[model samples]
Target: MILRFSQLIVGLILFGAGCAVMVDAGIGLDPWTVLAEGISKNTGIGIGWVVSITGFLVLLLWIPLRQKPGVGTVANILVVGAAMQFTLPLVSTPDHWIARVAMFIAGTALVGVASGIYIGARLGPGPRDGLMTGIHQRWGWPIWAGRLGVEATVLVTGWLLGGTVGLGTVLFAVLIGPMVHVSLPVFDGRARRRRHTTPAAAVGGLSAPGT
Candidate 1:
């Protein structure tokens, strides 16, 4: 339980931090966020609205994919949107181009960290990602194909909506995969330690209830 809770915290932190940094960077942002920012800019809707609408619609798509929603899925939808709405403004870069670039890099890197932790938490995936895997499973598509299809669609829609797709988008696509690859292991080690300290039931070899 402790391990799971820690993982949840780590995951949320990473995800939230990523959103914050990507926005403040003032360059292009992550793809999904790229879409949200685009909608916000053109529609004059709040960032949260854009995020929530996308997340909710993604989950709606997931239902047809046979992906049952869980706590992580629920949290995934709202948490980032809320965090983005709240934190993006709080995270800002200085006037210098170098400073803006630094913020962008840091924000993107933090996204990698967040992706790793949240995934390692073994919690449900974020709504968009969940939709990707769910469609792959339900439609008998390859993981790569499914992911690409979803992302491509989102990217286009977001662009049409007015999201900026620039260096930030490209950098994120290349870097985050490797970042998650590296960081999740450190968090997995922490989870393993917490599990070892947790007592299990002697009779059935299961964890105690509420544990």
Candidate 2:
């Protein structure tokens, strides 16, 4: 449990730092970050504050979906934005395009790795992830379809609101899914262990309560 908690904290911090790095790269942002940036632009609030607020708002949505948040979920709301705020000032954009591209790539990779680390803890999904999975569970939609629908809506809305949508955004869209796919198995041993140890849940499979 201690190790899982430690992994969750480290993953959230790294995730935030990765976001800061991508923002500093000045290329583009993930769909959700783009929405946060757009909201920040419109409201004259800091992006980190917008992110934290957006998370809380998303959590509210979970109430109706009957999704339960664990310690990781609440920690995700607080720690990620705070870490981003702390890291942004410490990181700077490079003048060279090559360096900026490198930063963007590194940031995207870090996000994937961090996601695997945190999700592997199996405490709970992050707010955005819960939204996607909740939609899947409630509507019988495929997880991919749910994710796509949510991301497309956010991307279009963010773009309309004057968020950056550039090569980096395209790169993230193309790469992040595959990155997480590869990373998850490497890090999700804990979840597999839990499933194996809890044979009844495994036997019932996807239809099981608390599955």
lDDT tens digits by residue: candidate 2, 110-129: 98898888887777789999
Clashes (N, CA, C under 3 Å) per candidate? 3, 0
Instruction: Indicate the residue-level lDDT of 26 in model 1.
Output: 71
> How big is the positional error of residue 24 in model 1, measured in Å on the Cα after superposition?
1.7
- Estimate the TM-score for candidate 2: 0.87
Give me the displacement of residue 61 in model 2, in angstroms.
Answer: 0.7
Best by lDDT: 2
Residue 123 deviation, candidate 1, in Å?
A: 2.2
- In model 2, which residue pairs have backbone atoms overlapping below 3 Å? none
Looking at candidate 1, the ten consecutive residues that score lowest on lDDT are 202-211
User: At residue 152, what lDDT does model 1 achieve?
Assistant: 84
How many Å off is the CA of 10 in candidate 2? Answer: 0.5
